[model samples]
Target: MMRRLLVVACVLLPLPAFAHAILTSSKPAAGGSIAAGHQTLDFQYNSKIDHRRSRLTLTGPEGAPVVLTILPSSATNALDAEADLKPGAYTLRWQALALDGHITRGDVPFTVTAP
Candidate 1:
């Protein structure tokens, strides 16, 4: 019957809410500190992400947000970017789209100390 078929289809389909990527770990960690100047930012996720579609935004000491360039050689489930920071509070906001086509985002707030 149509009702039974509809129920089956719903059961078979994967839930979108559960397929979103989660930040498992990150370099310079959240609320963590690092030295000023050139640094590599890394973000590891719970699932494989589309590096080409993912984004990393850095908010520097001046309170302006800049879109970081994603490194080409980074791993599938990880995002890596390079940044030159100054001594002040900063935040790295990231957005990732997983293999399942779900997008997830979060922020990493940290401080840049004098080298």
Candidate 2:
């Protein structure tokens, strides 16, 4: 009876929930530089994400933030986009929604150098 009660208690207890969607890697890496012109913007997370609901915002040296259209991805944990850029400082802001319903946001600051 005691063993059965202990098992029941364990089952009733709430399990600890793990947080989701940490940014693991990015193209034009943070504080890094990339060649100017057409480029691929990629951001990878630690877990699967909902690309449909995610956002990618890019702010250029012109001091304007433009919402970049995210492209369809074969990768479940990465967000991909494309842009035509000039040699300047830029910030890629990302908001990702994980499959588990968690949202994570961050920015990648990088420079675009003359090709």
Candidate 3:
């Protein structure tokens, strides 16, 4: 019975090699505040992103949408864009290719104070 239990546990346990995507960090830090009319918006990922399959967007306080594209280089996989944000709240929604080839996405909110 103990040997059978051990085999079952091993089968149920998470694999040593698994793949997933997560937001390690972000500028403005989700619900953080910053000056309005930001020259650039940034999103950082914990793992490498598949640029060809990634997408990002920034919505203004007025609900206007600004699309951000992928920027992959030797150093990092970052999504960025320039915006003339107005003083108010904004939303950032992002989707990307996980290391395991799955899609992962989430939304975050932030505020842009009037300069």
Candidate 4:
């Protein structure tokens, strides 16, 4: 009975990385440079966000986080963040709960230079 219970626990353990709203990819590929200052940052997720409270941050080269909250009335599949970027590498950090109730968070790096 102990052996069977142990197996069940192992199988049922939450795989947050799999279920959470993982940032599968982003428009400005990680560590890639955007010649034109990114007027917008787009994050593509493995799942839909909670929409009500999803948040995005653009971390400047100096490491200050700039908040880019969604517009609430936007589409469901995509999460958009609008920012006026300067010439520097920026890190994108995001968090959201999926429509399925899984909490997700992660970061992607990008660069912006003079046009």
Candidate 5:
């Protein structure tokens, strides 16, 4: 019975964890472009996130990482911020913490064009 118990444990452990805060959608999508000026950044996840514990970092063409302040929102599974962007490339890095205690991170690369 030991072998059978081990097989059952392995099958159960292989299940996917739905607690992860997966990035479902985003504004200024990956490999996308936006108009240069004041832009609102938004990120959506599959699970409810703890906005207080999350972070948004903006890296512009100059290669400086600026930590953005999270805007308050009624949406529990999203993050929002604003920044003035110049005509160049940028990467928006997002680190989110799900209510279930899982943390997820990803980078959204895009460019800004002169309006």
Candidate 6:
């Protein structure tokens, strides 16, 4: 009986780990660069996220944090936004809440160059 219960617990414990939202990829990929001007940001996650509860914050070269608008998503596991960038360094901080009520956050630091 103990052996059977241990096996069940092990199986169920790993399931919750899969529900945490993890940033799998990004548009201006971390440490990458983009052209200065209107740009679209895309963030892909490993699990389905609650878009309504997620947030994206952008910090420009001047060190001011601006909250970017979260656009409607066609893909359930991705978040998208838009912003007008100037030539400088920038960091996009993302906070995502998974369907299972877990919150995950990450940063994508990139630079914008004059085009």
In candidate 6, what are the lDDT values of residues 1-115, reduced to their tens digit?
8757645664477574446788888989999999999998999998888888999999999998999888885278999999999999999999998865667889999999999
Q: Pick the candidate with the highest TM-score.
A: 6
Listed per candidate, the RMSD to the true structure in angstroms reads 5.3, 7.8, 6.9, 5.6, 5.9, 5.4
Residue pairs with clashing backbones, model 5: none
If the candidates were sorted by their TM-score against the true structure, best first, what order would they fall in?
A: 6, 1, 5, 2, 4, 3
Candidate 4, residues 1-115, lDDT tens digits: the string is: 8757644554587454335577777777787877655476777777667777788878887787888877655466568867777888788888887765556788888878888
Flag regions of model 5 displaced more than 4 Å.
Answer: 1-18
Best-first order by lDDT? 1, 6, 5, 2, 4, 3
| Local distance difference test scores for all models | 0.87, 0.84, 0.70, 0.72, 0.85, 0.87
Q: Once model 4 is optimally superposed onto the true structure by TM-score, how far is the C-alpha of residue 106 displaced, in angstroms?
A: 0.7
Better of 3 and 6 by TM-score: 6
Provide the clash count, candidate 3: 0
Candidate 3 structure quality by residue, lDDT tens digits, 1-115: 8757644654576343324457777776798987876456677776677777788788876677777755454224566556667788888888877545556898879988989
Q: Considering only N, C-alpha and C atoms within 3 Å, which residue pairs clash in candidate 2?
A: none
* Candidate 4 residue pairs that clash: none
Candidate 1 per-residue lDDT over residues 18-103, each given as its tens digit:
35688989998999999999999999987788999999999988988999999998897899999999999999999998866657
- Cα error, candidate 5, residue 53 (Å): 0.5
Candidate 3: C-alpha RMSD after superposition:
6.9
List TM-scores for all candidates, in order.
0.84, 0.82, 0.73, 0.74, 0.83, 0.84
- Candidate 3 segments exceeding 4 Å error: 1-18, 72-75
| Residue pairs in clash, model 3 | none
Q: Report the C-alpha displacement of residue 27, candidate 4, in angstroms.
A: 1.5
lDDT of 2 by residue, 1-115 (tens): 8757644554575332323678988997999999999999889888888888999999999998999888885388899999999999999999998755657899999999998
